[model samples]
Target chain A: MEIELNDSKHTRNSWMERFETYLPEVVYGSIDGIVTTFAVVAGAAGAELQINIILILGMANLFADGLSMSIGSYLSNKSERDNYQKHLHIEEWEIENMPDDERKEIEMIYRQKGFEGKELEMVVNRITSNKKVWLDTMMKDELGLSEQKKSPLKAGLSTLVAFITAGAIPLAAYILAYAGKYQIDPFILSSLVTVFAFILIGYIKTYVTQIGLLRSILETLLLGAAAAMAAYFLGDYLEKLLV
Target chain B: MEIELNDSKHTRNSWMERFETYLPEVVYGSIDGIVTTFAVVAGAAGAELQINIILILGMANLFADGLSMSIGSYLSNKSERDNYQKHLHIEEWEIENMPDDERKEIEMIYRQKGFEGKELEMVVNRITSNKKVWLDTMMKDELGLSEQKKSPLKAGLSTLVAFITAGAIPLAAYILAYAGKYQIDPFILSSLVTVFAFILIGYIKTYVTQIGLLRSILETLLLGAAAAMAAYFLGDYLEKLLV
Candidate 1:
């Protein structure tokens, strides 16, 4: 397909989209992070947690979750770069040892694209004459790949930042709620924050894909609500049986 | 960067890569679907379930999760396309209203890449004379957007299919483990399947991002494991307090 062009406004700014695309991973990770933390805190509080225990779980998840996301992002990106390099190595070897076969492949590819007879032959010759052109054709036509690439460290770090930021929501809620100098309403405070975060996660989807921000928010709210409800009801059942 | 022929295998058949990418999603989703389904079943089973209630929850998660994932995928894709069109509209407006601003943009973009005064001016003029060229310049230089976007529906449908297929794992496991006559160790079976699914999820990362197979599998495994473990333990604790 050919390229497209239009407005400069869309080009000049994009802090919104950046935040949105990062939303899925950040929000997905965070919800899991916050919910997990809340369950731990709620249990500790139920089992009679000293503030210290709550603080401990909070700190551990903050570091461990963030660290894990960072590492996951880093390692995943590294692997992509490595895969690209492996392909490059194979191309290099093919050019050195099997030029004729590689050239024939190019000719066939061009022919398939509607070029025919002498024209096809000419196009293939022009490309295969240069090693770089030959390899480019192979990557595009055969691998059906393109030039987009990413930095592993940047990925690891962005996710880490996202994790920490989202994670702080529940911790802050917990501390402000029950662990304060004056004990606050734990259930109300934690549930509200969690619900809000869940909604935000959904709304953020609008910015990312821009289908319907309203819909995205609703969907996320549903998922979050569902998970929490499922857990809550099941908890009641378990409590009846075990506790 | 201009597309380069950097590898010979880029021309090889890519059906394998495409197929492999979805496998993990199917496996991971299936296994996690199963484990979580197992939990649902076990919880119901624990609740004095008429063996039938256990069956009902498992079937519901199996179908419901699959349905939700499918709908989520479809909407997200549709949303993305809508967003793209919205931006495209904005850009189209800019091109018609401010030709000079757009022209200068082309020059400014090339200038940053070491082109100077006269040379850059010549390049800009040559491109702007053709409406298509002008738009292409604006796209590449100003917006950095692409027209070769995928069909969101295709993406959504794939997720739906993959999730449905994956959801079978735990549902099947539980049905066999405690629901009916089975010789399987329930926890062991569910845990093993979950881990295996995670490994597959990790591997699929390579499919989307050109990341390495091993690294993707490892990262995905860790993330998936972390999410589930958090859920299981916290779920364990919450059952004691909230219910």
Candidate 2:
């Protein structure tokens, strides 16, 4: 039987389809943003700092931490892609230079799966005939590296955007208070808004984690509360000491 | 051909072998512990708090955060295991109660795998004849879940042990200063030690991450510094505002 190997069509995507690709980056960024930003707010509030100082510090941390995280994300993903490409190049060179050894390796892999005798020879012949398929098999089975599908630059951008967006939630109440738009205490209002954001992010996270909605929400709330409480009490203790 | 489905023997283990099993948990806990404890140390030091107070808060956070993390780790693992078992049961029920549908699924699955005619029927028969094999294949291919290998209790315990052990590194200098054993500034010493710990943890992380040692070390250092700096400066600004 003749074997057929065709490259998959890379279809042009609608805008919504493209957005789905970065949903994970967005969720991750939002989660980190909310947790860190709220921690800053909590710490400042615990220290009884002025509202303006709190807002200033929150804004500063929002951008600084967001940039730092995005840079880290970009570098890590880029490094992974580079590493995979390096391995791919080496495997391709080996296949070209050492066909017999490469064919034996494929035989060994299929033999382990119970293909044997004439069937094994036929399977090997079919795979080796297709250069693209041979390369893919070698990449996956030999190197244990799959293709990196994500765009590092886009991942970084998504992270920065999500961080700033979700991170703004914690500071919103403080900003409103500073602008003389709301009468409620900014700290209390910030806490409420942060909790709301936590629940919202937790709902989004369920899409990724596949955990129960309530459980995910509770987990997010617990994590945020723990980080914020730690920072808050540390700031409070330090203030007491300085006084 | 005779099919073999013997269960692998559970061997008696050396303590070292057991420790290896929890290595990931240990690394994760250690990284988290060091980052958080040092953040406390950095924030307290930035606010110019008394050294004793810094140590007190650092130690408190060391255990508290460790416990929190371990609990989170335990619950998450337990939930995952429970979820798996729940699905497993559902699959089991379907296979027993509606064998026709399950067998059709098996046929469709193999047909998609390019198996055809007699071979397709043979593949389905081979899988469905043994209930255990059928269940395993369904669990893997249909649900896209593998067996949970790590024990929740052991994972949690590992996290706690690793957290306290590695987390102590940041506070060592503070303890020494509190005991009047060191004349150098405790905060300065703590910073140095924390950096050292970051390097060490990064090296250990290379085992799990398979990233280059230098890159892992740099990543760890960058992450720790970013968090500590944020906390430290936030404390400093808050102190300034209160004063």
Candidate 3:
């Protein structure tokens, strides 16, 4: 038999939908990047370390960490997708081998939801008649699984790109300072830049999660500040002990 | 009327249940602590700064950041609880004043669930008879919210304790070195210590989240290493530019 191809036109609107799918990963990756990288800079500054050493360590951390995060994201997503497929297969097998048992499960599920008598039987009959519908219902109601179907590669790529882009923010001040154009302490500038990055990330997070914008921004700022404060004081105390 | 002393004997079993509830916060706090503090140590070492300076900054960071994290956790949790309570009040008000409309919503909700005829009417009747049950069904089915009565104070306390306890692991070597007891480079020792901490945290995370132990451990290791590497290199690069 000849196969009929059912293709739909891809448009800018579709691409935007895909972008929305990746938004969570982007937001999380960016937040992780800026916070961790800035913590490094703050630590170095607290130690009164030379600018050169800070640059080496910070740069190493930025690229290396960003790549590693992306790889980890890729693996995690891949594994989740694998697990989902495995379950899907198992569900399909059950439906094929034990039709009666599977149909009863649907009946019981509806019965528990207050369905009874003719209505309950009808729901079971209607759902079990369609293989696809039966499978979907079993997957959701019985196994509590939902199909996400996000591409692992795209997830990883988004994380990597967002990481590098956001991770560079704090370091920008230091880089500029080292270029002989700015006379101020690079650490001071780094702090200012990082705070701004934190606020921006928090603002973006609000858009994605629909949290109150001001609350999100303040929360991010507080969290970053807390991390830096702990690092700084700890370093100071240890220095005193050595002295 | 005599008041019933609705009291049960307090037992260790109840406390264990409470402990289980705080497990997620502990895991996250510990992870945050070790990673952020270690980032500081790595940054300081990269800059070739005085060991004393590193210790000072690191210790300062440990305490300050831990407290800050705890406070932030408290506020975030409180806000969530407040929002939930506010919505709950609104739901209660609607149910009281708009009983007819609300009952229709309940009926529609069940009908959509495939309940029909006698079963659909029973489901609606049973639900509408009890105010508390009706409120709960509306909250969950219509509002899509479930009550999560996790205490804000407990969450904050858990985060603070975990932050200090786990965060201290990486700094143990530095503290020992500062005491003039360890001859080896403290940074090297700290790296080893922090890696162990990362693995330990990952292992605990598995127990909490039911993720594969090996995968979790590896992910944690890579993430921590990536952060340190980026911090170290960036610090180095900036140093050269300044020179």
Candidate 4:
């Protein structure tokens, strides 16, 4: 294989790599976001809010959470890349000035791997003679610096977009699908569909996380249950006291 | 100053580097997990659940979410290390068998970097003289493999155990502190405290995310509001309807 790492090449494929890195999160995140959003809308509708109010809650969640996820992903990646570059610059400068000391380090490395006598010396001499080859080797083997840098733009765009799109599906299901089904209170049907979405979202987590399919599905279902149970009991007690 | 890039003598403090690497996430994840748990407990209490029940919900959330986060971090890192190892094995075999091809690849690499004539040939001859040196050069420069593989068990355990610990804080606060208030009316005080934690978590997102802090805080707060509001309403209706 070719010697010397190409930083620029890595930069070129960064967007593609970032997309690949984020692929798993997108599907799983969408399911989670959608389920959570549905829970909010359904809960509101159950509490007897207007249809418009339920929709407003869904929209607000979509926008707000999307923005937060986007920004968080962006900043974390940027800082990590910044840290990498800072170290790289120093490593580059070291190669330019201290060739002798650097060569000694190479000789020792070969020594550790069972090289000895003139063979070790010759190997170190050859590698150290070339500055570019030496520095690239140190960066890769010693520093563990890889070509992967998380892209802020890709992260921000993907997460925000995913959240919005996923969040919308449940809202749409509640409005178009649920409202059509109920001959009585249109909103009641909406609640059922919304709760159903939570279970589905929880189930999706198993695939993304390799969490047992049964456990993931059940755990997510419990989140919904806990939410509903907490709300209902509090509402029941508060209704008694407030009235 | 070392002119050689393969220098192994790094003067930088290892402890400092490690501390910097992990400290921020530790603080962020711990505080954030606890705060989130607090909010859930508070909202549950506000819905007027008994103190014991509110405590149960908060405890459940803390353990569940914390475990989930820890497991995710472990698996993802392990997969990355595994993938890197696979690439490294291929490079190792290539170095062992195809000296001529590997030498050509090295020459091709430096040629692209603007080496030519006698100087280029000298550099290639010097690097390829020892196969180990050649292999080292190729692995570092071309393949981008690092020697450090953070133990999967350690990372996983740290995240999972830390999350669970952090998650416990809010539950403790609800059970011991808030539950004692209002003659042990566990729900309202717990929810109010939870909203406070949510507000705090939102505010931290600014620092955590490196974005418009106000927007981040606002978004998180909205999520808290919607979750609590939905729980109250949906729980109310579901309880009545189920009966």
Pairwise TM-score winner, candidates 2 and 3? 3
* A1-243: candidate 3 lDDT, tens digit per residue: 111111122335877878888987898788767765676677667666566555665566567657766766676677677667777888789989998898988887666555678767866776677677677667655665556468989999999999889988888887787677799888888898888888888898775655689988987888778767665555444444555
Select the stronger candidate by lDDT from 2 and 4: 2
Estimate the Cα RMSD of every predicted model relative to the unseen true structure. Answer: 8.8, 6.3, 7.1, 9.2
Better of 1 and 2 by TM-score: 2
Instruction: Compute DockQ for each candidate against the true complex.
Output: 0.10, 0.13, 0.24, 0.10
- Per-prediction TM-score to the true structure, in the order listed: 0.56, 0.68, 0.70, 0.56
lDDT of 2 by residue, A158-226 (tens): 998998899899999987997899989988999998888889988987766667899889987887788
Estimate, for each residue in A67-99, the C-alpha lDDT of model 4 and write its tens digit: 544554565566556655666667677767876
Query: By TM-score, is 1 or 3 better?
Result: 3
Q: Give candidate 3 misplaced runs (Cα > 4 Å).
A: A1-12, A37-50, A53-108, A138-144, A185-188, A191-195, A228-243, B1-24, B35-50, B60-160, B184-188, B191-199, B208-212, B222-243
Worst 10 residues of 1 chain A by lDDT: A1-10
Better of 1 and 2 by DockQ: 2
lDDT of candidate 1 over A157-230, digit per residue (tens) = 77777767776776676666543644665655667787788677776655555666777777766644544444
In order of TM-score, best first, we have 3, 2, 1, 4
lDDT of each: 0.55, 0.73, 0.72, 0.55
Candidate 1 regions with alpha-carbon error over 4 angstroms: A1-24, A28-243, B1-72, B116-119, B193-243
Candidate 2 residue lDDT tens string, B27-146: 778877787677777766766766755665566556556665676667667767877887888989999999999998878754544556866675677668778768865765465455
Return the top candidate by TM-score: 3
Off by over 4 Å in 4: A1-69, A88-142, A146-149, A163-243, B1-32, B35-57, B96-99, B112-136, B181-243
Report model 2's TM-score to 2 decimal places: 0.68
Evaluated against the true structure, the overall lDDT of model 1 is: 0.55
